[model samples]
Target: MLSNPYFKSVLWLLGFGGMGYGLMLLTEPNAEKIERIKASGSNSKQSADDQRKALFMKRLQEAATTGAPVYRPQPQVDKKDS
Candidate 1:
């Protein structure tokens, strides 16, 4: 087998190719977390009621310290009647 050039070269090339592929796989493993990020992004918008409550509480806190008027913002006017 030492004198057969074809067999030696074929085996050598195969071994090198396998080592390269293995290294690549090890360095960059798989991950599929895009679905979680996309789901959270869509749910980031706070509801109108929650926003109003938060703002009211903030105003109340300020009124206690500075005696400022505590007022909630007006409700949004929905233009679409359909």
Candidate 2:
């Protein structure tokens, strides 16, 4: 059986799968820690989004007060030239 290619492949797959499953179990987080991790992740993401929005609004406000155009037209180029 060990000399058969299919049997060898099956053994390899089972060995790898068992090792991966064992590692997963060993590293699995408890429910409380999982919840805490999730909350922190969301909080950080929200704050990051808020910061980006504030920066964008500030830039827009500056442009508005300074009478600078926010949207600029792109220069036209012929495709054949490139």
Candidate 3:
């Protein structure tokens, strides 16, 4: 590998070019994507609401087939007389 005359020079130039591009990125400011992300909140809320509605519909379907209530109660916790 050391027999090639341009080996060391090629590597040196490649490393310097990579560092230059990195420095350029560091000095440049990107704001459009940041603002878009900050403004993108409604989709998550909408998705969660849609999922809950779908789950409610599924439970309703099950309840309509059976005669049980769609809502189930949590198990009662027994407490000792403190």
Candidate 4:
């Protein structure tokens, strides 16, 4: 049974998978530290709605600066057109 090629391949694949999982567990602490470093770089801490408003304001400012036409579709247009 030990000499069977199919059994040997299955055991090899399982061993590699176990080793990969173990490596991920071992590196979890470093992964958390990397995440903390990434999160610390942000300047403003705003709520979700506030963040969305800020983004909208930014796009409006850009449009005004670049003279891009603002799209205002007629309310009478059917939603099916979209």
Q: What is the C-alpha lDDT of each candidate?
A: 0.78, 0.85, 0.83, 0.83
Counted clashes in each candidate structure: 0, 0, 0, 0
Tell me which residue pairs clash in candidate 4: none
Report the C-alpha lDDT of model 1 over 5-74, residue by residue, as the tens digit: 9999999999999999999988763345566666676645979887888888888897889865556545
What digit string (tens of lDDT, one per residue) describes model 3 on residues 1-82? Answer: 9778799889889999999999999877579877776788655566767989988999899888987776785478999899
Can you tell me which runs of candidate 1 are displaced by over 4 Å? Answer: 32-82
Model 1 residue 44 distance off true place after TM-score fit, in angstroms:
23
Please provide TM-scores, in order, for all candidate models, with all chains considered together. Answer: 0.34, 0.45, 0.33, 0.41
Model 2 CA lDDT for position 79: 82
Which one wins by TM-score: 3 or 4? 4
Q: List clashing residue pairs in candidate 2.
A: none
Q: Give the winner by lDDT: 1 or 4.
A: 4
> Using lDDT as the measure, which candidate wins?
2
* Regions more than 4 Å wrong, model 2: 35-50, 53-82
Write out the backbone clash pairs for model 3. none
Please list the Cα RMSD from the true structure of every candidate, rounded to 1 decimal place. Answer: 17.9, 12.0, 13.0, 12.0
Task: Supply the global lDDT for candidate 4.
Answer: 0.83
lDDT tens digits, residue span 2-75, model 2? 89999999999999999999999999999999999888776445676798898889978988898776677446
Scanning candidate 1 in windows of ten residues, the lowest lDDT window is 28-37
* Tens-place lDDT digits, model 4, residues 1-82: 9999999999999999999999998877777798898798575767798888889899889888987755763357557854
